[model samples]
Target chain A: MFSRRLAFFLVSLIALLLAVVAPAAAQESVTLDFYFPEATANNAQGIFEEYAAQFSEAHPNITINVVYQGSYTDNRTIIQTQTAAGEGPDVAVMLSTDLLSFIEAGTVVPVQQFVDSTEGGADYVADFFDAFLLNSVDENGQLWSIPFQRSTPILYYNADLFSEAGIEAAPANRDELVAAATALTAEGRSGLWFPSEGFPIWLFTAFQIAGGEPLVAERFDQVFFNTTATAEGLQYLLDLSKVHQVMPEGALSWGDGPTIFASGQAAMLVHTTGSLTRILSEAPFEVGTAFLPFGPAGEDGTGYGAPTGGGNLYIFANSSPEEQAAAWEWVQFLSSPEIQADWTARTGYIAARESAWATDTLTALVAEKPQYAVARDQLAFAGKEFTAFRSIDIQNVINTTLSSVIAGDVTDIPAALEAAQAQIDSLLAE
Target chain B: MQAALPVTNRSVSPARKPWSQRLLPYLMIAPTFLIVFLFTLKPAVSAVIDSTLKPARLAQDPPAFVGLQNYADLFNPTHHLGARFGGILLNTVLFAFGTVAIGMPLALGFALLINRRLPLRGVWRFGFVYPSLLPLIGAASIWAFIYADQVGLLAAILRAANPNWLGSPGLVLGAVIVVNVWSQTGYYMLLFLAGLQGIPRDLYEAAALDGANYWQQLLRLTLPLLRRTTLFVLTVSFTFAFQAVELLQGLTEGGPGDRSNLILYFIYQNIGERRNWGHINAITIILAVIVLVFTLSSFLFFERGGRESER
Candidate 1:
């Protein structure tokens, strides 16, 4: 009886061991953790999970652990803290504007190596917009983060408000924009209201870029805010507040302009093209989209240029080569034309791949809604803002200063800009 | 024969031994020490080390060990860190003081009113204390909607008289102070009432016989005896006011152009919004020191006052 029991126990233990180790042996899967700031509400979440599942099913050798690390700020915090502790996510999705510092800090690996390892490394849309690819590259010319989800600033107007004001079409140029905004402003309505802090930096940076001002040269370590175009951009928003009275009071307090616009309070809002899907769902009135109003010269005049607002995938140096390969494969999979089209359709973000828009899926979607193409159309006009040491905070301070000026708290344009420049310089110095 | 047994043969069964006789006490407390060391002490020690460095983010910039430079920069009036500390600290202190000043008396009043013979006192007490049980974020969100600028409930109500309740600089502090008081008053009042009940009725009777009026008795007898309880309430309330972030964050975000800005909110904005952890850590260390000093001073003052009163 004892012999029989021993044999039975051995058999059961062997079976249990097989049960535990069989899957790992069969698949040889590497567990990859991909971190993105995109929250659960963004359709990007669903697309990522689906892509992960698909990749796993196809390779049968990889498992991607997708984590929604909260907002962009939260993601940065988590990455910074974790990386400091010598542990960070294997894959991180970061904004292009924020990646330069990360690269400088060596927190990210250059995707160029992986791309080179693959076939046709140069084919990965090396030039995003005219100057954007250069802006995205680190000082070493290493592409630290690929632009997976890119967007530009666009104007979202209430079609119902336009109809009520007897306006037929959205303004294409600065004069037309002012006239439209002035006409739209009445007793209970404001002509245009961008979020106080939300897209002001994007709007102003675009204005500067369009006005032919070098915000930050590639080699320069600081922003050039002393230019006439920079001053003009600052004054334009301030005038919207004091001179035109077209912007709302307490705009400095506005966090998200779309919500205000959707609530039928703001007639027109300048926000990211990324907000289109969410706005479409929430807007009570008909929504119309157009490129941001051009500056003084009209359409050919200083036009709207925007910095990219979206996350790019980056592989961490801490990750194993196998894990890196798996991550890169996953990134390429997502960036492919098929997946990019799916992503664009599901989420409001414009695909970073220029070729993705020409796909049948995107073409069909765009045919149904031509407004979705604005971000892509404005790619030529948009360029990233000058990001240097303490750039993020410097930008925020500058934006706040502009916001203050627009809110009529600071009236002198050059003085406020000078103060902002000095503040940024001091921050950079410290 | 049993008495003559070898000494080595004698043994105490582990299960039969009493808990006091075993090393189980240390075993029981070991987990707590492990947790405290791992979670609290380590992070704090690291933050202190981090505070002495030049301000930068990204883990690779080896924190330059500039001893006391960050601290000096923090106290320097021209710097943003120093400027933020100056303004935000004042707001934080005012917020804490205002919350406690208004909340304590109101709580005590409610407690006293409820302690008396009144219908549905239990229900009223429950209703009063209910808000304290709610999460700070949810409560703040509700208040935020009510205080919304353009079409807020309060704004709509006051629109007839210029609509200046929440948005105006003069009224913004009052608005937040009201919310803070509302959230905390009930819990403190409940504590005060408990302290009041714990006092022997004979003391009040003796005071009454000594010709002490109700107000005098309250000041002389009630307050003096409830000093310990008052100190506790003040400490907890002050800490709550200092630490409460969700309410301020959700409600105003330290804005309408820095009117409602507080130190904790400033720290959060610096760290989270700006990703400037060095500056964040620097500010944190300063705030920690300030809070420590204030707490120690308050405790010392209270202890000295109590001792003097006894003398």
Candidate 2:
């Protein structure tokens, strides 16, 4: 009645704006491939599926395709193979130490971009434990990954054995560890199975950190393998068998430790938190957990050092921006305190987030089984794992050198490390 | 040789075959040719070329043409992979010779023992073949448990000695070889059994009628008569032994220091750990050459044996 033509034109302009904005809101459902290393957690496939289902229900526009890769090594192989062919998984949980390899290969996208863009993103990144986050960032402090299923090596001592041997408590220092092991060694069983064969390098690096210095720091190309740390670490392991006679002389597979401990063949085991659940369930005797015994208190306050191990969530470079966005949302949801609490409780992985400790799920779990809290408390002393450029090759050098000396094939530990350090330096020079 | 065939035939012939017939042979061999070319020849050639080239430190960068640099690394005394090349060669020779040399004779011995009429012969045949019937990996696992450090069946039986079977560098290779022989004897026994049945009975009868004893007949007739089967079995077994990988993978992992590290197992280990494909491919080329030499020599030796038997 006032101005019919003018009103019609205004309505037409509004209709045109609606057409532009509608499609932005209505996104096509993105299906993301999430590669998970199955061996890291118990029933990881089922747990991943449940989490994916929860995310899908919340978003309803993104579908997460959970894929179980065989092991951490297998995941690396698959990722490298697929990414070369340009069809890698949109998201994956690879070894935290695998960051350099993946980054150097240009196959991954830094989660830092998302961290910078999101509201209260700094606070979000700040929530994870410092020890776990050490392996997640680069030299420039560029965040390439997020800590999820984290682990550290801890001492699993047999309480019954302690009582039988008249030991006061779990060993807390090098001298005490030797004494307890000596006391526990008996007619049939050794006191401790310090695993150095199947899984040689990880636990050995813990010894290195406690002995004096870390094998490597943030720089991938840098390594310190010929120091007092390396010598003392290998010497300790060698003496455990050669001098103390508390363990066997030959290389014992780390995989066999649980069975040996459960069958009361080993009075104590130095293994990862990942095996805690299985050892706890399988042992007939009451299994008590404690922090690892520290080595020679060094100038830099190197005592009680354990490696922060297990996998981390990484967003790959090959994904579309839309898929990356969706994967980030999924990653955030997976690493949230609630989910992390449940994950820590269900699996033996240490909760990477400080907030997860306060959650009801984890608090209840720790209250029921105090063994669940040992690794968390030990996190105060835990340091970064032995990671470098070409990690596997360098690790093999360290492993074989240690294995050779421990197997009694070589008696000169210092000379062996010197030769190894030379070889490592040559390799890193490449 | 194959490419020369059509040209030589056409040139040396009095008359050419019809077009369809000329094409028939090629058509028949095309699938095999394509398959061999794609799977075997191509990869082999590619490996040879890749052996001369190395990828950049970071994989994304272009590969460098480092001619013979990888080969140099292979011979480098300081390098772990290279330091063990000599030991790997020795281990391979030991595995191949040890398995075939001992296993074949045991197989023939068992076959002769069973070739005569025995009670429940079928059951005995199945019993002897049972170990080989188990999958290679499965059989290796069984032996692994049997050879475990302590509390194993071997440990339990030999409680007085208390040997570390799979752990000792001095003993691991022999331990692995024992498992290989255990798995192989049954299989070679089956082959010998088939060959034993195929032997003409009249020849043995003729030897027996010559006033010869059982050992005489065995030395003269049985050994000569089974020449072809022996040749086939030995050739196959040596090739099989040279390529042994799964047993090591399951049992010893070529460890306690390269004591059991055969050539093939070393290559397999490198393929997993070594990022440089050039070096890995060089190792592969070396393994392939070893396999080739052993295979060629086995056939040549067996063929000479076949000819000597005729004489």
Candidate 3:
């Protein structure tokens, strides 16, 4: 009886071993090194890991190793450094505008390549918002990256401050913004604070979009900084702080803008929609979101526009074919309507695809907190983020132009901008 | 304990060493020499080469020689880059001068105060050096709060009279200087303390016997004795001021729009933000040359002073 029992135990153990080993032998396993940055999203790393686990569970052969890089720039640096050493992550989420940089470096495989190879390619590409896709294109107009944590600059206002000041609604037009800001202005709190420090080009670009005309057009080499609309926008911004004294007189920090509003130091703040969850959760009083206030630029004399800003998923060219295929699947999984809905619910990033909004996850989220839909609605008016060949250099030129004018270091705005335009052109001409 | 002793290759001959043995000194220094070559000399030479080339915008683009175009672009004058570059240099110079002018004297004063026997003299010395011992980031955060807008210690104290210390371009350089001075004074003070100790006690005694008062002895004895140390401190502080990237990064980030921008921070920005390697290398070479010239001149002056004093 003891021999029979021992023999049965050995048979069962063999069966279990076979069960584990059979699948291992039948299919090849792939491991992917995925690099991501810690943008202002809540628990982004945790959420990403959870998704990776879910994907791996569905596809047992593929395993993803998620590495959290520092900032978006740091992510690019890591990829470059690693690529130089013949080692790089299989996938990374870099700035959407950085598509050009990666494309120029030949480090990233265009998602279109995979999209074309996959089923429902046309519909899948079309599902993403046009505003986001604006920055996803390369010099040849190929969709090089897929938008992930897409965002737009929006007005985050304090409802309590609005009530206290007896303002009716969130500002829409330039006059309304000015009037509302003037009303909300107080001893400590400014009427409205726009962050203009440490890369103010984003803020300026948002304003310029509303003011009409992007800094750059369809061509990577072209720039339109010295336009009348740009001057009007600059004058208005200057007048708000310099002449009206409604906003603070110096460069406000993007890092501090949300916190300042949440802490009631600023009545209203102009910051990214990505900051929504943070601002909403942190504010003691009611918080509201709205489209960025328009300027008198469009045919209707009021144009509401903001540039989309965020990261995009790009599969590395250096990755193996199988890894690239797996990375592409991972990208699709993340950007799928269902996953994007869950993503939008977890973090306040605007859902990259319009279809994501219709999903139950986002439907319930939006219904529960209507403020979550503001950026999505405002996406209709959003434009391309500033991206060019050697974009960062051009951006610095524009940023310094804006900052110096604010700092009173440059007295001539038009001349400074014109010189910047010439400089930018010359930089591209080389 | 060896059963039998044997002379190995290490102790083979007194007349001539083996090749490996002969190469001992060079072998020992190989790592150091390689490190210096790889990190310092190679990069410096590459920077010079890079500065002369029109940078490849794309990594795959062929390297093209632009002669001194990269260097000239910095001072092109068409764009405000040249002007901006000039402004950055001026700001750095002012920063260096300000730190040296204010920091050295303050350091000397603290050293003098704690040098003499007083109650809890160790405590005073410790207090003076404590800030220097604290990490730069920590000191930066503390001062950031002090200089923070709307809700800061200075804001509370001045009651709305406090200007935007870190924000206002007019006052930002001064504000950064103050923070640098606060953190650096202690370090210079320690040097001063060493110099003070080196001065013979008999000199002060002799001056005292001659009926010199405390202030007079300080002027006639301590000041003259500390001239070398003082010069060293000034030169060191000035050189240090040029290397003030962390404080600027932590404090103002070379802003309210380039108000507090110094040379090192500008180079940092070029590398990190602009990614214009050619521009970065050019700026680096220029700043290095400036500091090198200043340092060499100061070294000569110090050497001359030492020689004349000896005579």
Interface RMSD in Å per candidate, to 1 decimal?
A: 3.9, 2.3, 2.7
User: How would you class the docking of model 2?
Assistant: acceptable
Work out how many backbone clashes candidate 2 has: 0
Model 3 misplaced regions, further than 4 Å: A1-33, A39-43, A46-66, A74-88, A297-302, B1-25, B79-83, B272-275
In candidate 3 chain A, where is summed lDDT lowest over 10 consecutive residues?
A294-303
Best by DockQ: 3
- In candidate 1 chain A, what residue range of length 10 has the lowest lDDT sum? A248-257
lDDT of 2 by residue, B61-161 (tens): 77889898888888886875666677778888988888887888998998998899999988888877888888888888898888876566786788637
Q: B7 in model 1: Cα distance from truth in Å? A: 14
The TM-score values for the models, in the order shown, are: 0.85, 0.89, 0.88
DockQ scores of the candidates: 0.27, 0.31, 0.35
lDDT per residue for candidate 1 within A9-79, as digits (tens), equals: 99999999999999758546788889988622466677778888988888787888888886676688788
10 residues in a row with least lDDT, candidate 3 chain B = B268-277
Please list, in the order the candidates appear, how each scores on TM-score for chain B only.
0.85, 0.89, 0.88
In model 1, the clashing pairs are A206-A305
Q: After superposition, how far is residue A12 of candidate 1 from its true place, in Å?
A: 22
Backbone-clash count (model 1)? 1
Better of 1 and 3 by DockQ: 3
Task: State the fnat of candidate 3 relative to the true structure.
Answer: 0.35
Clashes of each: 1, 0, 0
